[model samples]
Structure formats: C-alpha cells, structure tokens
Target: MRDIQHIEIPGHTLSVRVDPGPEREGRPALWPSVGEYPIYDPFLYTTMTTDDERNHRFRAALAHLAPDRRILDIGTGQDLLWAREGVQAGARHAVAIEVIEDAFHKAAANLPALESPDRITLLLGESTRLRFAPRADVCVAEIIGSLAGAEGAAAVLADARTRLLEPGGLVIPHRAVTLAAAVRLSDLLPEQPVAFAEAALPYLRSIFGWHGSPFDVRLRVENPPADALLSEGAPIEVLDFNGDLQTQQRTTTHLAITRSGLVDGVLTWLNLWCLPDEEPLDALSMKTNWATIYLPLFDSPVPVETGDVLELTFAAALSDDRVHPDYQLQAVLRTADGQQRRGSLISPHHGGAFRSHSLYRDLFPAG
Candidate 1:
C-alpha cells in the first residue's frame, strides 16, 4: 500500500499521505483552529460564530447574569457577539475590547448598525494594557485557547478581576483545565509521515509568518483515534478564571499505562466550564472548535506494557509580549525493564529556533 499520494491540479501540486484507513481510524491532520495568535480570518470567525455549543453556554450564562449589569467583553472579535448579546440580554452597558485593529475597526463600523449600539463601547487595544473606569459587573471573554490558558486568558482574566471588574464580579467560563495522557503516535497513524493537509498549508504559513519563523508552534490533531490513548488522561494545567488565576504554572502528573503498547508522546486537550455548576466541554470527547493537541516527547519509540508509568511535567509561562504563553513539556517513561526513556519539547508562541524539531523540519522543508 502506498504510504503517500500525490495530487496535481492546474494551479497547485500537492503530495499528501494516503490515509491509512477511513476517517473512523483517526488519521491525524494539521488544523489551524487551536492556536491563539490574535490573527483574524473569515473562516476562523465563522467557526467561532457557528459553534452552537460555545454559543449556547456563553449566551445562557450571559443572559442569566448580564441582565441589569455592566458587561466587559474582551477579545470581542469582529462579530461583537457577546457584547451585543449582553446588551440584548438587558445589560446596562457593554465595554467591548479587541486587540486586532482590523477586527476592532470592523466591530466599530458594525456596532452602530446593530440595535442598542449606543450602549456598547468599543476599544482598540489589548485588554491587559488598556484601562477603563467604573468597572463592569461581568467579564465575558472566550479567549480560552485549545490548551486552556494558551491565549493569555489567565493573565488577561486575572487582570480583569483586579482592574476591569468589580469585586466579586462574574467571569464567564468560570474554569478551564488542560488534560494530558501518554499516547503511541503510530497507533494514531499506522505508518504515516506527519504532515499538514493541503488546506492547512496556508494557515501553517500564516502561523509561521506571524511568529517570524517556524519556532515549534503548537500542533493540534484533528480526529484523533480514541484507542490511541495508552493511558487515562489527567489534568496538567488548571486555570480557575473566577478564582485564583496565575499567569505561569508548572504541573507534574503521573499517568499509569493501561495497555501494552509503545509510547512516544503525550496528547493534551482542554476542559472548560462556562459556569461553576455547569458541565465542562471536553475537547477530546466533544466536537468543539478546540482540537486535541499532540505534544510529541520522544522521537524513538519505547516499548511499554501495561503498568508502565509516564511522569509528565508541563509548564506555561508568559512570553515577551505577555499576551500569549510559551509551553514546555517533559516526559520520563518508567517501564518494567528498570530503564527510562526521556523526552522534552519547548514550544514558544513566537520565534525561538527555526525548524528546531523533526516534525517542524518536515513541515518547512529545505529550500
């Protein structure tokens, strides 16, 4: 069977892996929805706007709490959905913040066209940097990244609590946590070489372009196999948006192997709750825009049977911009053979090293 396939058309030529099996088999492909680069695109906005799960939870929370209260909507995006929705829900007034200028301008131009536009205030700047008076009674920000706080939600929300919101004010998406587990990459894709789908190439280039170079940007896999997981997932990073929230964190968790298999990496996903008492939306189990992330640890596969232990160390810290996070993952696999296999990955939000790893090397081939 062919491991790879080439397809050519008039304007473009492409070579892609022949998916080992049908879609149910979980052939991994690169997708652009997971990262938080603050770049605005039409399709990306469409995904967020159309996500009924996200919309229902957020709208319900807003409708319930935003009434008769001033609202603060950070990263309001171009649609101004939350800000407008908050007003529609009976908010006294809503302050909408957008970091991307184009989006902010688009929102600025459109806010006036909507009903009760006079009650919405639009700002063009980072919510963390911009200051406003008479704090709101509710802060609604859907900036939670695929990896939870990967979008600077912790830092941004923490700042909101202290400066943007009134004391004891409500925060939408009350909590978010990152879950991780040991996985055998080959099981996810039998003998396929890791590569981006043709549709993903443009966005891949955009991510690299935004970062100034391909410096190990976070990789999100679409349609990962349920059986690919070698161990039960455990929470590695937890961000309590309405409570104690920190910008930097280091967490170590042990995942016990549940089956006999080879190990090479950890798969991580986000669990988020719009309110304290609500059920969380799990990325691994649900069909949200947030895709599960593959944090590759080992290049060479390590043999492991049931009862092996993989200790994973995950760290998230603010980069220079202080608006996005840089993530580092370290794994130590302890098996029955009395030997250990160790691997680590340093993923920065922006430039650190160009094409630093094998996956990246293949993503951006030699020119």
Candidate 2:
C-alpha cells in the first residue's frame, strides 16, 4: 500500500490515509471507489442490487406519480436509480443532495447520463437541514444504519419532510417493520461454550446474594430500515419464528426468564434490508454492509426467576468508530421478588481491552 497522509478535521492534522484516487480538499482520497471501510457515505457500504426490498419500496412509493412530478433525493449517493425509476414512473425532475464532497462529485459524474441528463440534479449539503428554492413533490432518503439510527436519519427525514416536501407527497421505503423476542442469553453463542469456573467464580460474594455467576442472554436481530426506526421505551412483542429463520429487525421487548439464575450480560444483533415478500428474512438470506453492534446489558451479579420480566428500552443513534454508531440494548429487569435491576450492559468493546470502571460500579456500587 502506498503511504498517504490525510487530514480529517479542517485546519487540524490527523493521521489518516487516502486510497488510490484523485486528491480532494487538502488530503488524498479515502478509497479508490466508495465501497471501502471508513467510507464517506454509508450508502456505498451496500450493493444496490442486494437491497431489493428497499428498491421495491422506493419504486412503489413513486408508482402513483404523474408526469412532471418533482422529486428530491436526500442523501443520494453515486446511484441515481431511484430518480431514474421515479422519472420512468412519471416524475419529471430528480434533485439529489449529498454531504460528502467526494461522493457529491461522484454522484454528479455518475448520475448525469443516467435516465436523462436534464432530469437529475445533484447538490452538496447536509440532508438533516437543507434548503431548496423549488419544493419537491416526492422525497427519497436512504440514510438507514445497521440499527436504523446512523447518519442522523431521524433528523434528516423530519427536516426534509417539513422543509422540502409538498403536502400529500410520498416518501420512498414506505414502511419498516421492527420485531423483538426473548431467548436464553446462552443461546446466542452456541458455537463457543462458556467456562462455568471463569464466568461464575467471582460473583460468590455480592450484595445481591448471588451465589453463582450471572448468566447472560443474547438477542440477535438484523439492521432496520430508516422508516421503522427503533427508539428507547418502544413497546415490542416476541413473535414466533419457524427456527428456520436466522435474522430479524426487532424492537424493544420484554423477556421472561423461565428459571431462577444469576443474570449477567446481553448480546444484541441487527439486520437491515427490504424484503419483497414474506419470504422469511434471516441471516442466511441477507447480506448487510454493517456488522453486528453488540452491547452487554449488565456486568454485575443479579438473579431472576420464572415469570421475571426484563423490560427493555432499545434506542439507535448515529456515532463514529470512536463510539458505536448505534445503540441496541435498553432493558430493566423486574424480578419475581419485585426487585428492579438495570439490564443495559456497559462492558468494554468486544475483543478489546475490558474497562473495569463501569463493571466495577455495577458489581460494587459506592454506598
């Protein structure tokens, strides 16, 4: 690899490198194209064809359009398929907005000869807050993340709807469905058996009178679409899956423990994509740009019993590598004895050095 120095924040020097590409601003290009990690735009993370569900949703959103309908593509990447499809469905103009300078140029260069050069227009700006002289009849924004909370999708959609859309205009990616469930914490890592000695030994003496190691439950899910964003305190239900399914886009839900045992940690997973039909979404059938962002719910010793309800408040937000781009776990466990314990884990990052501060506080809170 060639050695290339780069700058992140303007007027500041940072140790970063640009991939093989034309230089932009003050630094070399980040990647040769847009599919690499540390990508400027999240949309580049996914292949256009694999997102059939969202593509279908976007197409359906424009099906009712009449000729000459003006549409705005918020967070539009190098691909202008939505605009082209919208035009084919009667939309007259497609205006695109992007924040990354490199992606902005890419979109301009790539979208010009798409369906019609005169029909598409690309601009550079923030999607969360944008201004346009000509209002749009339809707005298409695909700013979803691994958990429906990255890239400020909520703010961007809300702002675009309020400031840029015409009344009765439709938005693409019609609806996103989020589901949730309760499974034994141990079920998440069936491939790796945990050591009873290493996991259970330290919790013998605790304020909760926990005699054994706290058992951790894991909940795996798929990334969600922007339309069906998950929030803290959202209500959810555990639906039945045929065991043939592998991934899901679940929301905050309550888990009832069937046995009395120590409660330790939680693992969360996400899946994001659109399905054309009820083909049963799962890990085997889907490919995502983002990997699983797991957060441990607790690091202390706790206990639970049959019928104990773990109330969860799941939320997703935009973040960087410095911090997780989205959050997936928020739970409050209600024991059979009427005790309330926080179920959201604050352990260190996975495979990284474990930070004992939060775990220590959880295990032994200051009196």
Clash count list over all predictions: 0, 16
User: Model 1: what TM-score?
Assistant: 0.90
lDDT of each: 0.81, 0.45
- Worst 10 contiguous positions by lDDT, candidate 2: 28-37
- Best prediction by lDDT: 1
Put down candidate 1 lDDT per residue, 1-367, tens digits, no spaces: 4444444334334343333443433457665444588666768888889988788889889989999999999999999999999999999999999988888888898887999998999999988887888999999999988888888898889889999899999899889999998886667655555665555656655665565544566777877878899998999999998888889999999999999888878888999889788888888887778888887788767788888899999999999988678898898899878788889998877778756776555555554
lDDT of model 1, residue 311:
90
Candidate 2, after superposition: displacement of residue 225 in Å? Answer: 21
Kindly list the per-residue Cα lDDT of model 2 for residues 248-336, writing each as its tens digit. Answer: 22355666665665555432323333323323233212453332223446655466666787776655433343322334566788877
**Which pairs of residues collide in candidate 1?**
none
Over 4 Å off, model 1: 1-27, 32-34, 190-193
